[model samples]
Target: MDFGCDPGEWTDAWSATGISHHWALGTGHCIAELKALADLMDVEFVEVDPA
Candidate 1:
């Protein structure tokens, strides 16, 4: 779980969506909120060090 800015949005629950690994994906989620949720789920959010 990388704590980085990945572009994604939540689609409909009724409809099934296929996974795509396109380079031009759209971003619509709040990173901070996602981090908090991940923490509650006991998931490690690791950020890559640019150094």
Candidate 2:
């Protein structure tokens, strides 16, 4: 998914168990893109810290 021109980058990092997908999104524009995606998908966006 390309969100126009940006200097931020992302990667699809997989765990050793290969059972989960982790996504690390950048700041600023990333927030907008994520919110837009959630709105388009008709889902609530919730962020939880796995501490």
Candidate 3:
């Protein structure tokens, strides 16, 4: 699944559905922080070209 820019707000949604992986495009500003949050949730984080 993909959580564009609201990863934090979507945590509950992700957990409810048992999602463990996601792609976050155009997250250059907070990629590191997002990755850390994903790690805390035991989810895999992938980066992709936003273009």
Candidate 4:
């Protein structure tokens, strides 16, 4: 989560379809890690208020 982005560096990197696809895959891996942690603690992973 500590992504250090230089100005204009990520602009063209994600402009192509293949690069965008890879970005999506990487994001999915992050989500999977959060889910795994939640499961280990027996907690539900919610992104909104539990009202």
Model 1 lDDT, residue 6, Cα: 42
Instruction: For candidate 1, write residues 1-51 as lDDT tens digits.
Output: 332334232333212455444212223355567568669988765543433
Off by over 4 Å in 3: 1-26
Clashing pairs in model 2, backbone N/Cα/C closer than 3 A: none
Best by TM-score: 3
Sorted by TM-score (best first), the order is 3, 2, 4, 1
TM-score of 2: 0.35
Off by over 4 Å in 1: 1-29, 48-51
- Lowest lDDT sum, 10 consecutive residues, model 2, at 5-14
Model 2 stretches astray by more than 4 angstroms:
1-29, 47-51
* True-structure RMSD, every candidate: 11.0, 9.2, 8.2, 11.3
Comparing 1 with 3 on lDDT, the higher-scoring candidate is 3
Q: Please give the CA lDDT of all the candidate structures.
A: 0.46, 0.54, 0.71, 0.53
The sequence of per-residue lDDT tens digits that candidate 2 reaches over residues 1-51 is: 453334242222223446445454455556778878888988776653323
Q: How many backbone clashes does candidate 2 have?
A: 0
Query: Per the 3 Å backbone cut-off, how many clashing residue pairs does candidate 1 have?
Result: 0
Q: Can you write out model 4's per-residue Cα lDDT over 1-51, one digit (the tens) per residue?
A: 333475356555546445434222234446778778778988766542213
